[model samples]
Target: MPHVSLHTPIGDVTVFEHDGAIVALDWGWVEDQAQTALLDRARQQLDAYFDGALRTFDLPLAPVGTPYRRAVWDALCTIPYGETRTYIDIARIAGGSPRSVGQANGRNPIPLIIPCHRVVATGHLGGYSGGEGLPTKRWLLALEQPEGALL
Candidate 1:
């Protein structure tokens, strides 16, 4: 695995790649300091994003998971930037029930790039993998939709 760590508004992000595609993107308060060519590019992009200069990520990712999980991740990327989708909505789109979508969403590896944070509960902000909990989730949603115009 090839890994790189970069800074972001949410803090340090560690992007791991396997066989030329990203396998995971993790958020942490601190990360093991190491640098790579890929890390440099990822850092640049992440900085751009946090600075509100970039709206989309253009990085190769290959998260390893079951077929269903892979399908879920693929469907997740279809979710446009600055938009939120309910678990039920994603369930119908992914051809599964809401509970299944929740399961898959919990397993999303590349969080921000895949944009799993864009999914919310039917009437509230949903869970987040990052340790900061709902506040982090709320902050991310706010970053994507600063005016509270999430739909």
Candidate 2:
């Protein structure tokens, strides 16, 4: 597995690749294993995204999951950065039930890159696996919202 780690607004991110396509994005300082040019480029793109200079990702992705989970993650990739959607909304879009959508969301291996943090509940911010917990989730949401939009 080729991996690269870089800094982001939320925390350090580690990107993993398999079969020439991105597979996972986790939060942590990367270990000193081997690196590749593709990993470097992925790190650069992630940095640009955290700096608000990029709104879309252009890397090849090969996330491993079931057909339903892949469909959920694919739909998640289509979610614009800084935008929040309810689980029910994603369920409707993914042609699954709300509970199933939540399960997929929880199983998301790529967080910031695939933007799983963008999904929220109807009345509140939902769960997160990243640093600072729910506060981090709220910050990401606020970062995408217009000034003074945070409550």
Off by over 4 Å in 1: 29-34, 146-151
* lDDT on C-alpha atoms for all candidate structures: 0.77, 0.80
Q: Write the per-residue lDDT of candidate 1 for residues 1-151, one digit (tens) a residue.
A: 5677766677777888676667788775344555666666777877887777778888887888888888888888888778888888887777788778878988988888888888888888878877477787887777877564753
lDDT of 2: 0.80
Report the Cα lDDT for candidate 1.
0.77
For model 2, how big is the CA root-mean-square deviation?
1.6
